[model samples]
Target: MPTRKIRRTQLLALAVAALTVPATAALAAPVPADAAAAPTAPLAAPATTASTTTAPATAVAASPTGFLNLPTSLLPTDRAPHEISFQYRNDSAGDQSIAPQVLIESPVGGPFLVPTAVSLQVETSDGSWLPLPLGIETGTLYTNLIPAKLVLHSHHTLTEHYRLTVLSPSLGTVAPRIAFYG
Candidate 1:
């Protein structure tokens, strides 16, 4: 009975998470040794990182500067996160680093999202995470973007993470109302 209940709960959480996006191998199987699916866009080989995008503890992350507006309909919670890597050239001042912004959005019905915690991580080519300066909050659809002076260099991959919650009663009527870090 206990096992059955646990399975049901897992399925429920997975179902809710899947509502935001298609299931990826990491979230579907969690085989850490296996490589995740490449981006829909063309890309290079995956590099092993001392850091991962799955948790706040492992601050190692990738850049979000590619997409003009990243859709989060299937955005897995930062806790049981998904990883996507994309290459970026830091074309900011001196063509060395850039401070990027991430806008958090949810499915229609305008779910009230509060990014309790958020970060944009840039991973260097040699498998090391560049230090991210604190982000400044600008608006509701987005808040708290990486500061302007954080130095990021060429040939880097970027990842993003956010620990958030939906505040609308319509979005949180179910039992596990908040997403917890895995």
Candidate 2:
């Protein structure tokens, strides 16, 4: 009799386990075709004009003189003695005159030769600065010629510094240091 009870209990447990699996599977089954094909509601459009109106205007600043606006790596390296020149213009709407100057220094702690043929012109007005015609040689391997001058107005005085180095056996480098005064 005990064996019969044990067998009955085993059969009941197996039946219950089988029934639970199918019930769980039914819950996980895919939705009917009618529900799967239903359309989703569209998302609301973002507000545009209000956001733009609240944003602040961007400000642009002018670049200082003598500083290379371009990356140093972008400068040419062609194994030649090069001449670097400096010029400034006063684009201010007001009538203001500025005196600009250029100076050159050698890293070797000696006076670098200036190109005798090159004529530097410095001019200033109530509005802008201009450079006179000058000659600059390009392409050669040497280090004697660099710039050393204080190009400024008669009443205004300032000093600037520059450095030169050999970029390649055939290419050279010219860097400018500039200063300004009223």
The model with the greatest TM-score is 1
State in Å the error of residue 91, model 1. 7.3
- As for candidate 2, its clashing pairs are 78-171, 79-170, 79-171, 80-140, 80-170, 80-171, 80-172, 81-140, 96-126
Candidate with maximal lDDT: 1
Model 2, 48-163: lDDT tens digits are: 12223333433211121122111122223343433444433222222222222222222244233333422232222222222232222222112111111122222232322122
Question: How high is each candidate's TM-score?
Answer: 0.30, 0.21
Query: CA lDDT of 50 in candidate 2?
Result: 20
Give candidates' CA RMSD values in order.
18.3, 37.9
Q: Give the Cα error of residue 91 in candidate 2, in Å.
A: 3.7
Provide the global lDDT of candidate 1 against the true structure. Answer: 0.28
Local distance difference test, candidate 2: 0.25
